[model samples]
Target: MQGDTKLKVGILTFHRTTNYGAVLQTYALQKTILDLGYDVKVIDYNNEEIYSYCDYRVLYGKLPLKTRVGKIIRYSHNKKIAKTFNKFRNKWIDLSVECNTNAQLQSVEDGYDAIICGSDQVWNPLAIHFDFDAFLLSGVKGKRISYAASAGNITLWEKYLKKYWICLHRFDSISVRESEMIQPVENLSEKKVRLVLDPTLLLNKKEWEKLEEPLGNEIEKDNYILVYYLGKNRALTDTVKKLQKQTGLPVVLLGRQIEGIKSISVPAGPSQFLSLFHHAKFVITSSFHGTVFSILYHKPFLVFGNGNYNSRMNTLLSALKLQSRMIDNESANLERINKVVDWGQVDSLHKALKEKSINFLIEALR
Candidate 1:
């Protein structure tokens, strides 16, 4: 490690204040930079004014919901179990307060060493509902590096092509999380985009502790299946009910509170979040992070799709060769409680990807 450089890095995560994934990803990013021997600080991203505290902003902007009603309406239509759009909307409002509340967002721009834009779904136009390429179009004063950034898919937006193309020229270095994202980011930005692991994947199990909850009531470390469901289809619920009836092993479903399921509903926070990943018998998930933790823990899992869900989870699953475990929402058959026996193939692929990704991030930070 270089002792003299004393690098200062700022990570921007569109933290919805009450999100588990956002918090963990931020933790992983900070830990990695700290491991690389730099001064690392997580910007209080849910607020804009907090950006003034850091030298560079690694932003994760959330979707816009202008008013309380707009937020309620936007999240109301979606079928989430534990998370609410209103909660997410409130975070963005705080960010807006931090940014525009003072009415001079640009005034807080002068901070420090480098600004890292992602390792997230930042490129997803729908999720964030903002000009992702805006920083490029408007420009930033400090040296810029896009670290493992991606929206979710491999598709490119035509509206931001010119700016996207130009911004690559400005970046000190650029990296994309998914392998498939490379060609698209390259075709659009015209720069070589390196593939890196999701920031959550950057660290291993030992590091997940700081983000975990108090061990006071940690349900005894037993064999319980970790079911990660985002789809609210009756078929999915029916499967969980039947599985519990048959296996008689309690199934812990991770999400905000939705409806129609009797399985344990874990809130979206640190303690249960880490515990779910740490102690699952096997993981069944539609969430990308769920699959990520399952892989890190060496647990076999079935990855399912959200009803008409988009590309984020699929990209990572495909890259990791766990495609068979993924059940498409349209094609999934909930009646079958099947177990995968010869997942040596999945294990091998995960090992190789893990090494390459570990090498990629380690090399890049230098």
Candidate 2:
């Protein structure tokens, strides 16, 4: 796709996920690669050997065990959400359906000009339990590129250090979404890692404007607050309720499972998501993608990170100087939450980030 070569590009991501940030980032990366004219495909990690142990018990149920000699059929492992995710994700790209063994992935190297392992925490070793093999980053034989991939926290892990070093050493180019992670990545392999924006930021407000068939400005005419949660923390939930009681505006929630006093329970797609930001009086969310769309639409929002989990939100928010907008759900002030953010300035920053990111992608892919 770059030249006369039809880029049989395969991307590795945590795609069988319901996470909004994960899904949107995948969509952004695929669209970016497609816009570059590459023939792309997305592959998911799967292993079906588990739950068979429990199934063999006579009390609950029994599975057909052809252990004498047979193929390890993995398709039966992923069902419901996994199947649904693949159903929708496969629509975007020609899905990879042939690989069942490590040998298959190795053979796959012959099909593509390059493979990108990116846009999410793909390199995180913790993924092996959920997928067949997560070190797919190390499996590619052609040109390898990793973009905006975070190894969760950049701290030392003796087990992963060697593989991390090897993968980074072998890549043609590497970039991270978080600035704080640049040092750790370099320390691991001495690779000069570029600080690139997330793939979601590659497109501007105008580009997003085209994808979303605009919702009529009917509901947006009234004032309401938007809330999204990523925290398992209870304090964050209490704050959302308190804010709504005091402000007396209806709260429309997204990306959370908690019951709301005055809220609508619906998955927010691009248009509804955009509308939430386009018209919200204010926002309070603990999710990273919630903050992303808020900033994209120039809406003032409060962000809370998971303290137990090492979240990359702090580094990103600091870079944008939106640290003031981030509310520590543990200790929050209702008075300050009411303060409005300057939509004009946020719009300018998003514009600059989008422009810089688009230019970088065009240059890097070349």
Which candidate number has the best lDDT? 2
Q: Which consecutive 10 residues in model 1 have the weakest lDDT in total?
A: 50-59
Weakest ten-residue segment in model 2 by summed lDDT:
68-77
**For all candidates, what are the clash counts?**
18, 2
1-366, model 1: which lDDT tens digit per residue? 233587666665555434556556656776677777776554433433322222121122354435544545434432242244334334322222244322232333335466666667666564545544433323456657776677654354566566566766777767877666788777766666787777787776776755555322534455676777665655455555555566667677665433654566544345557777787766666677777787777675667666433365666777766566676654345333265534567566666766776565555555
Q: Write one digit per residue (lDDT tens) for candidate 2, span 222-249.
A: 4887877764656667777888888888
The count of residue-pair clashes in candidate 1 stands at 18
Candidate lDDT (C-alpha), each: 0.58, 0.64
- What TM-score number comes out for model 1? 0.74
lDDT of 1: 0.58
Once fitted onto the true fold, the runs of candidate 2 whose alpha carbons sit more than 4 angstroms away are: 1-6, 44-94, 98-100, 128-136, 209-223, 255-262, 267-279, 308-311, 329-331
Error of 1 at 258 (Å): 6.5
Query: Candidate 2: how many backbone clashes?
Result: 2
RMSD of each: 7.8, 7.2
